[model samples]
Target: MTVRMFMGDARVDAIAPDDRGLAYGESLFETMRIHRGDIPWWDAHMARLTHGTQRLAMPLPDATRMYAEAMALLDGADGVLKLQLTRGGGVRGYAANSDAAPFWMLSMHPLPNRIDSLDTIWCEITLASQPRLAGLKHGNRLEQILAANEVRAANADEGLMCDGAGRVIAATSANFFALIDGHWQTPVLDACGVAGVMREWVLAQVDAHVTSLKPSDVECADAVFLCNAVRGILPVQRLGARAWPRTHPEIRALQAALAQSHPGFEPLLEAS
Candidate 1:
C-alpha cells in the first residue's frame, strides 16, 4: 500500500494522534477508482469533498496539490485511492483549534475481486436520520460498519439498510437502485445515506427517479443493482428469499453503458 500524508499543504510522515478525525470522527473521505494513474471522475470526487468540507466547516486542502499526490500514489496502477481529510490535531477537548492546520492522507488499495452477481440481505442495523449529515462521506461510519459486519457473518456480498422510518436508504458501502416499470428508481438521500460518485454518473447517464422506496418495492422490482465508485455496477441476484436473474438484460445494458463511459469498468463489462 502506498501512502502520502500531509498537514495543510506540507508533506508529513504521519498524522498527529490528537487529530480530530481520530478523536471525534471530524473528517471526510473519498474512495476513487484509479485507472492507469488517473482518476476519470476526479472532478466529481473533488466536488463531493468540497461540499463536505464546507458543510462541516473544516478547512479545505489545495485541490491541485492533492491531485498531484494522488497521481504519485497511484503510480500508473489500476486500483483504489482513498483520500481522508481531517480537522487537524488539537488538545484533549471537543472545542476545535481555530488555527489548527488541516490534516489529510492518501492511501492506495488494490481493488477487490470482482463477482458478476451478488447475494445480499436486509440488515438489522438501521441508519440514523440526520439530514444535515446526509449525502456526505464523513468519517463517522459506525452504522455502515455494523451493517457490513452482518453481511460478512452471513457470507453475503452486501447488505441493504433502511432509515428509522423503514424507508430503504442504501447498501452498506454502495448506493442501490431498482428497475420498476421500465424505469430506474433509487432511494432519495435527503434523509440518510451517502450519495455515491458512481450513482451520480449513472443518474446523469439515465433518467432515474429519486424517490422514497420500501423493501417491498425492491422485492417486487424487475431488477436490482448496486453501484459505487469502486465497483461500477453490481447485479444483485438474491436478497433474502427473493431472487433475481443473474444476468438481467437491462442490467447488462446498463453495465455495458457504464463500461463505455468509465474506463475502470471495462473489465466488468468484459466479464458479462
Candidate 2:
C-alpha cells in the first residue's frame, strides 16, 4: 500500500490526535478503481464525495490537486484507490470547528482477486432508518462492521442486510439487485444504504426499478447479483439454502457493458 497525507494542500506527517474524524466519525470517503494510474470513475466518485461534504457541512479538498496527488501515488498501476476526507482537528466537543482546515488522505491498494460468484448469508444486523445520513458514504460504520463479521464467521463471501422494517437494502459492502418477472429491481436507498457508483451504472444500463424488496422476493428471484466499483459484478451462487447458477446471461451482459464503458472493468469480463 502507498499513502500520502495532506492538510488542505500541504503534505502532512500524520492525522491529528484531536481530529474529528478520528474522535467522532465526522468524515466521508470514496473507494475507486484505478486503471493505469487513473481512476475511470473519478467524476462520479467526486460527485458523491461532494454531496457527502455538503450534507455534513464539511469542507472538501480541491479536486484538481487531489487528483494530481492520487495519480502521483498510483504511478501507472492497476489497483484500488481510497480517498478519505475529514472535518480536521477540533476541540473536545461535538460543535463544528468552522475555522479548521480539512484533512484528507489518498492511499493505493492492490486490486482484490476476481470473484466469479458469491456465497452470501442473511445478516441479523439491521440498518437504522436515518434519512439524514442515508446514501452517503459517511464514516460511521459499526453496523456494517458487525454484519461483515457475521459473514466471515459463517464463511460466506458476503452478507445481505435489511432495514428495521424488514425491507432488504443491500450487502455489507455492495449494492443488491434481483431479476424477477423479467425485470431488474433494487432496493430504494431513500431510507438507508449507500448509493454505490457501480449500482448507479447498472441501474442506468438496465433501467432497474428502485423499489422495495423483501427477503422472500430475493430468494425467489430468477437471478441475483452484487456490485461495487472495485470487484465489478458478482453473481450470487448461494444464499442460505437457495442456490442459483454461478453466472447468468443478464449479469454477463451487464458486465460486458460495464467493461465497454470503463477500462477498469474490462479485465473482469475476461475473468468471468
Candidate 3:
C-alpha cells in the first residue's frame, strides 16, 4: 500500500506517539472505491467525513489537497483509497487541545476480490447504542473487530449485528437490507451502525423504508442483501440454517442499476 501522512496542510513522515487518534480513538476515516484512478463517490465520502469532524469537533483537512494527493497516489490505477483524520497529538489526559493541528493520512491499496453472495451468521456481539457516534466511521471499532473474528471462526463471509435490544442493525462491514411484504426495508441507524454511502444511494433509487427489524424478520424476508461503497450489492445466500437458493429478480435489477450509475460495480455484476 502507498500512504501519505499530513498534519493540517503540511506533509509528515510518521504518526506522533501521543496522537489522540492512537491514544483515545479520536479519529474518523473513509474508505472509497477507485475505478480507473477516479473516486466516483468522493464527494459522498467527504460529506460523511465532514459530519464526523463536526460531531467530534476535529478540524477537517483541506478537501482540494486531499483529492490531489489521492489521485497522485493512485497514478491511474484501480484500487481502494482510505482517508483518516485524527485530532492530532494531545496532552496526556482526556482533555483535548483544540488548537492543535489535525493529523490526516491517505493510503492506496489493491481492491478486494469480488463477492457475489454472502454466507452470514448472527454475531453474538451486540452493538452498544451511542447516538452521538452512531453513524460516523470513527476509529473506535472493537465491536466490529470482535464480530469479524467471530465470522472468521464460523467460516462465514459476514456477520449480522444487532443492538442490545435485539434489533437487527447491520453486517460487520456492510449495511443490511431485506425485502418483506413487497417492500424493501433496511435497519434504521439513528442509534448505531455506519450510514453507508451505497445504502443512501439504494434508498434514493427505490421506495425503501428505513425502519427497525428483528432476526426473524430477516430470516422470513423474501430476499436479503448487503451493501457498502466498495461492494455495491451482495445477495445473502445463507444465514446459518436458512438459505436463499435463488437470486431475486429485484436484486439483479438493482445490481444493473448500480452498474449504470457507478461503472466500478459493473465488474462485480459480471463476476456475479
Candidate 4:
C-alpha cells in the first residue's frame, strides 16, 4: 500500500481533510498498466485526463512533473499505476468556486493474478443516466461499488451493468465488448460508463462498432470479453448459466491482435 502523494508540484504526506474529492467524490482517476517501466498508452491516458479536467473545469497539475514522479515510482517495475486528481480542499457546498488548486496522487499496486478466463454476471443495480459525467473516470463510483458488491455476492470475476434504460454500458471496472454479426460491437458510452484505454485500443484494432446493445444481444453473441488497461483483455467463458467454448476464433484472433500490438499481452496470448 505504498503511495506517492502529489499536491501541485510539491509532494505531501496526507491530503487535506476538507478536500472535495474525499468529501463528495469530486475527482478523476486513471488506472494504467506499467510495462518495462513505461505506460504503453501514456498519451491516451493523459489525453483523457486533460479532457476530464477541462470538462469538469478543474485545474491540472504540471504534467511533466507528474510523469517524472510516476516513472520514478515505477523504477522498472511492471504493475498497475493509479493516478488521482482532485479539486483540492474546498468549502462545503455543491457550487465549487473556480479558484481551487488541484491535488493529485500517484500510487503503485501489484497487478491481480492473470485469469485465463472470466465468469461475469449481469448486475441487478442499473447505471444511472448521467450524460454529463459519462466518459470521465470520475471518483463518484458508488454505482460501480454497488455493482462490484453484486459480483462479490455472486462469486463472479466481473459484473456487467446496463444503463437505466436497459442499454448495456460496461462492466463495473472495465469495458464490455461482444462479437456480434461477425463484427465486434460495444455499447456506446454516451450515457454512462468510463471508456477504458485498452477498450479504445481494441476498438481501433478491430474497427469495432459502437451501437446500442441489450443483455440478450450479449447473451447470444458468438463471443464476449471485458477489457481494462491493467488486465489487457479477458475472454468471458461463462455468463451466469450460459457458456462460451474456449475455441472461439474471434476471441483467439483478438488475443493475437492484442499481443501483436502490445508485448505485455504476448504471454497471455501465447497461452491462449
lDDT tens digits, residues 1-272, model 1? 78899999899997798899999999999999988888999999999999999988889999999998888777787899999999998888877766788999999999889888889999999999999999999999999999999999999999999999999999999998899989999999987999999999889878999999999999999999999999898989999989986668878888888888876786354343
Estimate the overall C-alpha local distance difference test score of candidate 3. 0.92
lDDT of 3 by residue, 117-143 (tens): 889999999999999999999999999
Residue by residue across 1-272, what tens digits does model 2's lDDT show? 68999999889999899889999999999999998878889999999999999988999999999988988888787999999999998899899956788999999889888767899999999999999999999999999999999999999999999999999999999998999999999999998999999998898889788899999999999999999989888889898889995578898888788888886786343343
- lDDT value, candidate 2, whole model: 0.91
lDDT tens per residue, model 4, 1-272: 76888677778899899899999898999998888888887889999999999989888898888888888888687888999999998888977864767899988888889887799899999999888999999999999999999999999999899988999999999997899889899999888899888888888888789999999999999999888888878889898777996837777777787878887875353353
Candidate 3 similarity to native, TM-score: 0.97
Which window of 10 residues has the lowest lDDT sum in candidate 1? Answer: 263-272
**TM-score for each of the candidates:** 0.97, 0.97, 0.97, 0.96
Q: lDDT, candidate 4, residue 224?
A: 92
- Candidate 4 lands at a TM-score of 0.96
As a whole number from 0 to 100, the lDDT of residue 185 in candidate 3 is 98
TM-score of 1: 0.97
What CA root-mean-square deviation does each model show from the true structure? Answer: 1.4, 1.5, 1.4, 1.5
